[model samples]
Target: MNNVRSKICGITRVEDALAAARAGADAIGLVFYAKSPRAVNVQQARAIVQALPPFVTTVGLFVDASRCEVGEILDALPLDLLQFHGDETPAQCEGHGRPWIKALRVRPGDDLEAACQEYVGARALLLDAYVAGVPGGTGQSFDWSLIPARLSKPVVLAGGLSPDNVAEAIAQVKPWAVDVSGGVEQAKGIKDAQKIDAFLRAVRGA
Candidate 1:
């Protein structure tokens, strides 16, 4: 119930990021994909990262970006982790000078073991619902039964996770951590502090 780390994703504002940190988020995600409504550029991300207090993990989310593109951002950002939300090869996710996670859009009958093995380099595996044409932030929940009881790597359960259902999710999936974006937001790229506090409270109380 307790010690289940939480990440507030799709942060676009310094104040919102600070709110998440103040609300006890173990990590805060900064989206980098240009097409995403929650995406933040270098200047924006830099400011947000700078504003965060100690021990809050800074995650950079990228969607099938090129190595050159990732490298460029790596040079400028102070990200502690990378979440690959697209079909990036293990090698592509590697050598970015930060620990990385691989996000798999889970669907029925998908070979999660193989995928985990393939991305063996990832510190954790982020499992999100499979929504067509949407890399992430769709606020969709996947069937928890589909996830194997045990995986080679830790599972960062995502998709449609909010304070309302997260308690049930933590009981059912027992993920190493949980990630929420739209669930804690007032609008796209805008987080609600009350929602964030409620969500973290639920996580701790679950």
Candidate 2:
């Protein structure tokens, strides 16, 4: 079994996907929201997804997108999982037949347990730091104490994770997996290959 799984999100180019996969990423994310600067058109996403090597899961992220939009993207790109970053109801998240992961924007004084309870059927819960008026991809982390010791589903930690501190974060949280976007990028929508390799090596060591 993979010891410390890692996901590289917001991939926009073929080279980036290949770099992430070579760096040992367990999965890679493709942003489908048109509003996001990192967002990829259906054709672009399809090409990138097709170029990815075997054994690397592709995750499609949406922010309050309609079922039809999600379906079309899924048909276009062979994504392995769906991630809801906006305020999507459980009904909406489950409406798609594919397994889904829900993003919980961690905020001060937030009840992590209660939030996870709302999405009980989610394949996994991704805990990310809350950013006003932004649909994630923010290089900020929340307080780890907010996460409860016992959760019903797997927890995939995200937000501000980098090679510098990923080991400490994993040792403390012990999440089923960890995800990174801006942390491994040189700038928004641009990935740094060396950073990707370093981040993966750190997670592998954990």
Report lDDT (CA) for all predictions. Answer: 0.95, 0.90
Off by over 4 Å in 1: none
lDDT at position 74, candidate 2: 76
Please report the candidate that would top TM-score against the real structure.
1
lDDT of candidate 1 over 70-101, digit per residue (tens)? 89998998789999999888999998889999
Evaluate model 2: give its TM-score: 0.96
Model 2 clashes, total count: 0
Candidate 2 lDDT over residue span 106-203, tens digit each: 88887777767898879899999888998798899888878888887889999899989889899889999999999999888889999999999999
Tell how far residue 74 is off in model 2, in angstroms: 1.5
Query: Alpha carbon lDDT of residue 2, candidate 1?
Result: 78
